[model samples]
Target: MNRISARRGGASSPIFARSPAGSKRTRARIRGAALIGSLALAGAAHAELLKFETRPDGPNEAVVATVKLDGTSHDIAGTLAKPAKPAKPPSGAKALLIETQSSDDVKPLALERGLAVLTLDVAKLPDKARAPALRDVLGHLRGALKMKRVLGRAQGSDADAMTDAASAFDGLLLHDANREPAAPTRFIETWGADAYWREKPRVEFANGAPPNGRRFYLAGIAASTTATNCAAPVNARPSAPALRALFAALDEWTAKGVAPPAARAPLDADLAPAQDLKWPKIPGLPAPPEGARRVPKIDADGNEIAGLRLPDVALPVATFTGFNAQKNKKGPPCAAAAAIPFAATKLDREKNLDPRPALVERYGSRAYFVATVRVIADKLVKERLLLQQDADAYVAAARSAPF
Candidate 1:
């Protein structure tokens, strides 16, 4: 057997000893070391080491920590954000919000809800090694925080690794990149095209067997694109509403120790007609290559498919596209989508190609537009698609808009 070394708080010690067969002293030493390690972990759990640092881009302080993986001796960068006063987490269930990527858009909301948000970046590890590395990281966290429940968010190809590592957690939220959910893992595609979409699956087993003692895969939703796409820019962050709903569901499960009801049937938000519509050829611009997918499809009502419909889309202030053309051919397949301002005045509305007359014409007045927003907000809240707090904020913003 190979020797193992354990390090914590700038102290290092050999945790394993090789011994001659059937040696009583060596067996006792091994048992003693295991006990010591467990005690150390319990002690560390009581020490809350989270500290705040000013983020460069914003004035808000970010909770940051350095976490060393349990076995690999690899130090992983971590960030945490706590609520103003931590809510009493579910009894005997310490919940951790984990993100495999460095940046998290939902960190603020998570913190506001009194959940500690932990962000981890395992990009430095090789692809094949990331799954095991993630498992180790989760083990260290579970031991050091005394956590019994974990909620994770991962994107792209990393979703597969996260799923593999889900055995270490009570629940996981994966956003796969156009890949079908592997079986024994119950999955549902919520929205978007078949080629590029998001899937939310509850993974309770690995290769047809449960890997741990934990049961109950909580409710989760994952998009097919980059996980960041859920909350990057303010206007386009459709995933925010969905995430809030998921968290609420998770809270219930953690507190009550009951799994949510079966996953809801997926809604097909595809804009079938838009797929057949072709853009008029521009004289100077080159034509799109053959076999390229047509992005930016919109329904007759002008909403894009496969996204959480925020007030921005439901109420209609501007047309937001989630995909744009790359400036150069060598650039990414599609540029980030942007929200184009709708015409606020009648003259601009008449001149604009995609005139949004509804803002001024349909609602009839600014006050009416704000009222319309409130109505939509209430409907979304009832559907559980938008949180009440966020719905109020959205309505308030609409009231102040230059409609």
Candidate 2:
């Protein structure tokens, strides 16, 4: 549904100087004003109809809801809960989180893990309500860009845009009945994860945007450039390689004039002409060894063991840590209350890497250990697959999520 509105301008009637033309012009103006008013009213009404609403059908079923944003007014539309399945979730199945462009992906991730998964339409946001919802994000970006130059400072412009997009996502999640109904702790954790995932792509795009030489723009471009050039050497294994690869693919796709993976348009099309440039390649690090998998591990099926590897020292530990999960009000009933950690020993002792005693000391247990892990999708996916074998494994591991 589309709504058309009129713009009001105040000016003297120059047409009055003329004769018959003046009378005709006055009639046209009146008609236009009336049309504009009518359209505006209709749009307001439609917006109200689509606002947020929640419905509950049964226990264990997902609640369906929708929220519509109107300038100062939030109207709820409909809410309904999905029914529970006959087969209870796997013993330790907690909440399942899925990222996709459609609902189809949600169902599978939830079913396979025997967990309830919530999906949101991240691409769309209520236009009228966007301002208030995104205020903090804008403020943060503005503040971050004001800092003095530092070697490791995040790029300002790209970071700001990415932050803005993330704030929009948070707004959408705020109204999502599914996310709303979840346990507060679970909801917060999931919200953070979702926001992180949503921001990654936006940040990459923001960085890839042509540089404006402004603090924020330069900050973003710098980060994006570093990720493209030094990803493998700096981060390596499990996810770094893939992260670098995905960005590289986007870079290549932009060069070829095709849509970059799941992106909306050519990478640099909207950026200023001066901002369009290729990322510089890092000088060192040998190309990926042919036919060697980075994070080779047994999959849920066990029959298939496939994973990504970067040159990162923490790759093994991070990969191991991913195999854990936490228990909460939302997931299964376990007396333990918290999930255990699965530490990675192989990567911890690498001579070239910094010694992160914190990783071992904090997460170390007689039975398991924790590796310094950064929470990202590529890592999450690999960890999720490993935990599928035993629901408890996922719960224990999730509790230890490093993010």
Model 1, span 359-397: residue lDDT tens: 566566888888888998888687665679888988888
lDDT score of model 1? 0.48
Candidate 2 lDDT over residue span 1-403, tens digit each: 1111235355321110111346654564443333221112212322221111122434322222223334333322211123245475431322223221233312343344333333332234444433232232222212222211100000123222223333222111111111121111111101110111111212222442122111111000011112222212222112222222232232222223232233112223323221222212212222221221112122221111122222122222321111112123365322111111222342543443423233445456423432223333235344321122232333445455442
Runs with alpha carbons beyond 4 Å of true place in candidate 2: 1-87, 91-100, 103-106, 126-307, 310-403
Q: Model 2, residue 286: displacement in angstroms?
A: 19
Q: Using TM-score, give the best candidate's number.
A: 1
lDDT of each: 0.48, 0.25
